[model samples]
Target: MTPPLEITPLPYHEDPLGYFAVLRDRPGAVLLDSGRPTAPGGRYDILSCDPLALLEVDGAGRVHGDPALAGLSPFAAQQALLDRLSREVPESDLPFLGGLIGYWSYDLGQRLEPVAGQARPAVTLPASRVGLYDWALIQDHDRRESWLVGSAARRDEVLAWLSAAARPAEAFRLTAPFAAELSREEYLARFHAVQAYIRAGDCYQINLAQRFSAPYAGDLWAAYRRLRKATPTPYAGYQAWTGPEGERAILSLSPERFLECRDGRVETRPIKGTRPRGATPTEDRRLAAELEASLKDRAENVMITDLLRNDLGRVCRPGSVRVPTLCGLESYANVHHLVSVITGELAADKRPMDLLAAAFPGGSITGAPKVRAMQIIDELEPSRRSAYCGSLGYVDVRGRMDTSIAIRSVVAEAGRLHLWGGGGLVADSKGDEEYAETLDKIRHLMNALATPTNDDKWNKKDLHLVDRDIDIQ
Candidate 1:
C-alpha cells in the first residue's frame, strides 16, 4: 500500500525560485513554473525533487530504466511502470501532486512514426525522460497560497531540506557569444526547398529552424534566472537530470501551451504567427494588430488548428473536437503571436499517454499533414531537434497533464548551450521576412545571456562571434 499525501499550508512566495534554489542540487529536482511574476494569466506553480523511479528512452528506441521493462515499447513501458506507482492518494485541487515530470525530445517522434534516417543526430540525448515522484510543493498564485503535497513523513523530509541553508553557486557566464551554425545562404537554400515542396503539394506549411550554440561555464541555474527575467512566459519550466555525459539541464521560457488534459477535458493552444514587439506602446499595438489581421498568418494558424483538431480526434471521443478560438492575438514580452485554441474530450478508454503519443511533437511546430512535413524537415534541417519543439510538463497520477511547446528554451550540456529559433513557412512567405523572423524569435534570449548578471562585467575579448557554414543537405 502507498502512503497518502497530506496538504500543509506554508508562506506564499510570489517567486518559487527561492524554494527551488534549496532543492536544485539534489538529483532529479524539477520545477514547472507558471510565470506569474512577469507573465499574465498564470495560475499555479509546481515544484518537486528526488523521484522514486526514472524512465528514459534512448535514440535507438530502446527503453532504459527498470531492468524488467527493457524490451517493452517506450509508451507501453511508461504506461505499465507509471500505473504501478500510481496509487490512491489524498485528493487535491492542485494540478500536480506527484507523478511523472520531464521532457519528450522532438526526435522522439521517430519512434512513434517511420520518419527517420534524414536528419543527422548532431545533439545526442534521450528521446524521452520522466521521473516518478512521491511528493510535490504546489503554489496557487491566484489564491496567494502554498501547500506541501506529500505523505506526512515526506513532508517532514522536504521541510528539513528546504530549511537548510542554500549553498552558494558561482555566477554563470557565456565564455563566447552565441553563433549560428547555418549561414544566410544555407537558410535561403532551405527556404527555397520548402517553397518548392509546398508548390508540389507535398506539404502546406513547414516549420524551419536554425541552431545557435555558445560555450559557457559556471552555474546554469543563474543563467536560467537571467533568461526568465528577460522573457517570462506562463509555461516556463526548469528540469535537470544526470545523463551519460554528466549533468544536462533544460531551461524553458515558453509562451505556447502544447496540451492540457484535466478531468477528461483536453485543450491545446497552438501559436503559429509571430511579430516582434515594437519599441513603443503604439508600435506594439500596431504590430499586434498587424499579426491579428495578416491573411498569411491567419491561414497558417488555421491550418495548424485543423491539424491539431484531427490529432485530438484520434484519441478523443467522437464529435468532441472543436476549435473555439482562431487567430487570437496574444502579446508577450518579446513578440506578438497569433494563437488558436482547440478543445476536445478524451475517450473513456484512453489514457493521457495515449493522447500524448497521438500528438507528440505538436502540429503547429511540424506544419499541416504532420508526418510528411516532419520528413521534409528532417531532410532539410542539419541537426536533430533534441528538445526544441518537444513537450515539457507533467502527467500526474490523477490523469491531469499540462505541457508547453519547448520554444524560447535552452539546453545546457557538456559546457555548451544550445538554442533554436524557427517559424512556419508557407507558399507566400518571403525569404527575407522568413529569415528575419527566425532570428527575431530568439534574438532577445541571446542578448539577455550576453548581459552580465551582477557587478561582474563581460570581457569584450570573450564575446567574439563565430559563424560556420553547415551544408547538411
Candidate 2:
C-alpha cells in the first residue's frame, strides 16, 4: 500500500529563485521555473529533492557504461519507468504525489531508426530518465502562496528544513567565458552542405547546430539566474542530480513546448520560424508580419507540422489528431517565432511513455522526415547534442505531463558550461543568413555568460542590446 502525501502551506513570499539557490547545492534537487510570473491564476513553480528512485534508459542499448541502464532501449526504458510509478503510487491517488523529472536526450531517437545503413555519432546520454521525488515545493506566484509537499512520513523533517532555508542568503554567481566549437567560415561551409542534401531530395529540411563551451568557477544557480533574466520564457527549468560520472546540472530557458498531456489529450507546440525582435515597435511589427508571410518559413513550418501529425497518429486514436492552430506569431524577450499547435486524443490504452516513444524528439528541432534528417545531422554537426534538443519536464501521478524542447539551454559539467544554437535549413536557405540567425538566437545567452566586473555582480541593465532584426526569407 502507498502512503498518503501531505501538502503544507508556507508563508515565504520571496522570489522562488532565491529559495532555489539554497536547494541547488543539495543532492537530487530539481527546479522547474516558468521564468516570468504567470497570470492571475497559474500553475506554481516546482522545487523537489530526495527522489525515492531514479530511472534511466539508454536508447543505444549500450551496457559498457552505466551498468544500471543495461539492456533497455529508449522506449522500453520509458515504459518500464511508467510501470514502476504505477505500482508505487496507487491508481486512485494523484500520480504526481511526486513523479519523475529529467530529460530525454536527442540521441534517444537512434533506437527508432527504420533503416540500418545510416551512420550516427556514438550515444552520450541515456535515452530517457525520470527522478521520483519524495519532497517538493510549489510556489503560486499570482497568490503569493507556497506549499511544502511530501509523503506523510517526512512531514516534520521537511517542515523544519524549509523553515531554516527561508532565511536570507547571498545570491549565486558564475564567472565563465564561452568559446564556440565552430568558426564562422566552418559553420557556413557546413550550412551549405545541409543545403546540398536538401537540393538532392535527401531531406526537405535539417536543423544545423554549433556548440559553445567555457570553463566555470562559481555557483551554477547564479548562472541560471542570469540566463532567466536575459531570456525569460514560459518553459524555463533547472535540474541538478548526481550521476555515474558525478554531479550534473541543466539550465533551460526554452521558449518552445515539446509535448503536454492532460486529461487524456496530448498536444505539442512546434516553433519553426524565427525573426529577431526589432528595435522599435514599428520595426517589430514589420518583422512579425514578414515572418508570417515568408513562403520559405511557412513551408518549413508545414513540413514539420505534417511530420508531428504523423508521429502523434501512431499513438493517438484514429482520426483523433488535429492541428488547432497553424503558424501563429509569438514574441519573446529576444525574438519572434512562428508557432503551430497540434493536438490529439490518446488511445484508450496508451500511456504518457507511449506518447513520448512515438515523439521523443520534437519535429521542429529535428526537421522534416525526422529519422532521415537526424542521420544527415550526424553527418554534418561535429559534436553530439547531449542536452540540447532534448525534452525536460515532469509526469504527474495523474498522468498529466509537460515538457520543453530544451533549446536555449546550458549544461554545467566537468567544471565547464556548454550551450548550443542553431536553426532549420531548407533548400532555399542561405549559408550566411543561417549562420547569422544562429548568432541572433544565442546573443542573449552569450551576454549572460560574459565576465562580471570587480564586485562579482552582473550588470543586468547593460546586457540588453538593441534588436538588429534580419530578413531570412
Candidate 3:
C-alpha cells in the first residue's frame, strides 16, 4: 500500500475496536480483524458475532488496496503502514496513515477461530472500545438489542461476557415458540395492498415484520448449539451485554454493516436480498440460480446500491464514488444471497460521525427513504428492534471503526428470545414465497436451537399476495 500512513500508536493490549478509533483520529486505512474467543467451556455454548474486518479511510479518501498486509506483525507492519502514509501525504496532500490494526478470527462462520500463527502475542477482546461497564449485571431482552454507550468499568470486556454474567444462566433458553401472527392468506393480502400503495408513489420500500411468541421465556444462547453446527456465521453470534442504564440486551444473527470509519475514510455494506439454501445440492443450485436470475433480487440490490452511493456521496470527494461489484452471489451456511459492493473517497472536511449520521442504519436493510420503511416495520413486527438494525464493531481509540448489520440473529432477554428477518418489497412477489422467506430465516434460528424443523409450521395461505419482496408482514 502507500507506505503505511502514520497517525498514532495503537493500544498496548489487544483492542481491535480501539485500534480503529485511534487510526481514525490520524491517517491511513485501519484494517480490523476479530478473532474468536470461546467461553470458559471447551466449546462456547453461545456467541453473537462470527468474526469480521473494517478498512478505514484517510483524509484524501485514499486506499492501500491490500487485505493481506494486515496479517503482518503489529509493530513492524504498523510502522511500515505509517511510513507509506507519510510518503503519500506530501504527494497526495492527505493525512492518512494513523497506524492500522486488525481484529480478526480464522473463520467468519459457525464460531470464531484465531488467526493462524500470526498473533505472536494474542489477547482477548480489546479494552479500548468496550470501556469499563458492568456487563454481567445486564438483563436479557432478546427481541431487539440496542448499542448502549458504555461507562468506564465496562470497557475491556466483550459483549458475549453477558452470557456468563447472566444472573441465572439456567433461565437462558434460546427458543421460545410464539403463536403465528396472521393466517397465510390474510398476511399475503395485506402485502399486496401495500404494494399497490407503493406503486402509487405514496411510499418507497416498506419493511413488514411479524412477531413470534411462546408461553415460556428463553433466548438464542440456548438455541445455537445445533445452529452453530448447521450454519456458523461470524455475524451469527450474539452481543449480550448490559447497557448504560444497566439494562441487558441480546442481539440476534445479523448480516448487514451499518457504518465504519477509519483515519478519515469510511464504508458500509447493507444487505438487501436473500434466499434460503436448498436441502440438496441440486435444489441448492436451483435456489441459488433462482436468486441470481430473479429480477426481484437484482432490482432490490441495485436500488439499495444507488441509495448507498447517494449516501456515500455526502461524505466523499466529488466523483470519488463507484460500485466495485453489484448483484454478486454470496453463499452463507444456511442461505444464498445477492450482494453488491460500493466504494468511495471521503471528503477532507468530513468527520467520522457525519458518515454515520448520513447513513445510520444501512439502506439495503431498511429500504429506500429509510424512515418510511422503518415506520412501516414498527407497525408490523411484534418486537422492538433495539439493535437488530443497529451495528456491532469497534471504534478504535484512533478513530477508525467497523460495525455490522445484525441479521440472521437472535435477541436473548428476561427469559425470552427474539429472532428477526426482512428484505425489500417490490411489485410481483408471491405472497406464499415471501412469507416463507421469513420462516426460512426463523427456520435457521430454530435449527440453531436444535429444534425439529417444521415444513409447514406457520400457514401463510390466508395472507393474500401484495407485490414482489412481499413485505407488509
Candidate 4:
C-alpha cells in the first residue's frame, strides 16, 4: 500500500530558495538547506525532485544504482536500498518524508577503514551519491509553515512545478583566482608531518587541510546563492548529480552537526575550536572570548568530544553514550567555533545504517583516533576529499536523520571549483599558527569566490563579516 504521504498546505518561502528554484532542472535535485535565508539557522527546509533511485558509490567500493545493489557495501547499499523503499508515514513532523538524500564522500571513508591507497586521487567523483526521495518539500522556518509531502498525484505534480515562474541563474563567475594547492614549503612540510605524528604518540588529533582551486563558469545555482549569502549555515546543502565527471555539484555551507537521528534519539555536534571573526565589536568579543577561554581550544574540544563519545559507543544503548556539550561557543559567518554536544540511545538492534556504519568520516573531521585520524588524513592531504570532510544530510523514511560536517563545503566538478579549509592538530600545534589556521578557515570563502592574483599572497588581508550571535546549540 505505500500511499499515505499527503500533507499539503503551501506558500512559505522564508527562502527555501524559492522552492528550490523550481525543482532545479529535475532528475534528483535536492536542497536540505536551513540557512533560513541568511542565518538564525535551521528549523526545516528539505526540498526534493525526481528521484526514484540513483545510488552511485565507486572508488572501488563499487555499487552503482541497483541491480539489487550489486553485492552490497556502501553502507550495505544504503541499508539495502533503504529497505526496499515504500514506507508511508506522513502525519507530519517533517524531517525528510522522503528517504535518502545525497553525498558521503570524504572518500567514502576509504570504503570503511584501511585508508585505501592513501590519498591524491584528485576527484573523479562518486564515493557516495544518494537520492531515493518519494517526495518532499517541507519548509517550516519556525512555523511560517509550508508542507507538500506526496501523493495526491505527487501533490498535483509538485504543485504544477511550484507554480512555474522563478528563473534567474547565470551570474556565478570566478573563472580563476583561488590557487593554493599547498606551498608555503608545502604547508610547512605537512605541518611538520602533523607535528611528527604528535611526537610519536602517533595521533592525538590530526585534521589539517588546505586546497582552494578555481576556474568556474556559471550557476552552481548561482554559486549556491553566493554562498548562502556569504555564510549562513545550520548544516546547509545543495546537491545536483550526474557524475563520471560532468555536471557535479555539492555546494554545502555546513556549520557542523554531523549526525542527528531523532525519535530513537541520537545527536552529535563536534566542531573543534577555531576563531576568525573579529574585525571589531570589540574585536568580536575578543574572538568569542578567546574561543571561550582556550586551554588549547579546550584540548581541541575535548579531543573531539571524547572521539564522539567513542563513536557513539559503537551502536549506542548500553550506558547510551553522553557528553552533553563540552567546549561550547558557536558563532559563525567567518569563524568562531568550539561546539560539542553528544547524546545517544539508538540500539534496539541498531540501524540508521547502524549509525551510518558507526559514524562515517566525522570525529570533527577525522581527528583523535578515527581510524588513525583517517590514516593521518590520507598521509597529509593534497587532493582527494572529494566532498570535503563528507556527510551531507537526510535519511528519513520516518526513522529520521540529519547530517553536515562537509565543512563550509563546495565541490562543483569538471569545470573546477573545489575549496576546503581545516583544523585540529594538537601537540601545541603552531606552524605559523597552524598555517594561519588553514587560511583562516577558507578566508571568507576565498573572499567570496574571486579577487586575488598578482601573485595572490592569500589575498593580502581584507575579509570581514561578523555580527555574531548564532549559537546553533
Predicted structure with the largest TM-score when compared to the true one: 1
| Candidate 4 clashing pairs, residues 3+ apart or interchain | none
What are the clashing pairs of model 2? Answer: 95-397, 95-398, 96-397
lDDT of 4 by residue, 339-416 (tens): 879998998888777897788888888788888878877878856778888888888776778888888788877788
Model 2 residue 445 distance off true place after TM-score fit, in angstroms = 0.8
- Give lDDT: candidate 1, residue 250: 90
TM-score of each: 0.96, 0.87, 0.59, 0.36
Ranking by lDDT: 1, 4, 2, 3
Per-residue lDDT tens digits of candidate 3, residues 1-473? 22322221111322122322222212112222222231110111111121222232221122222465445432223233433422222222111212222222111110111112221211111111121111111111221122212222332243323224333223333232444445566567767866876888756665565444332234333344334445554443333343332323333344445565756666666566688888899999998898889887788788888888998998888998888788888777677877787777678876554465466556776666655655555444433444455455443334455556656555444444444555567766666777787777666555445343343243343222212222112
Candidate 3 Cα RMSD (Å)? 15.6
- Highest lDDT among the candidates is held by which one? 1
lDDT of 2 at 308: 97
Q: Is candidate 1 or candidate 4 better by TM-score?
A: 1
Clash totals for all models, in order? 0, 3, 118, 0
**Candidate 1 at residue 21, lDDT?**
90
Candidate 3: regions farther than 4 A off? 1-176, 182-186, 215-227, 242-247, 379-383, 450-473
lDDT of every predicted structure (CA atoms): 0.87, 0.73, 0.45, 0.79
Model 4: ten consecutive residues of lowest lDDT: 464-473
Q: In candidate 2, how many Å is residue 230 off? A: 1.1
Off by over 4 Å in 1: 452-467, 470-473
**TM-score of model 3 vs. true structure:** 0.59
Give the 10-residue window scoring lowest on summed lDDT in candidate 2.
Answer: 464-473
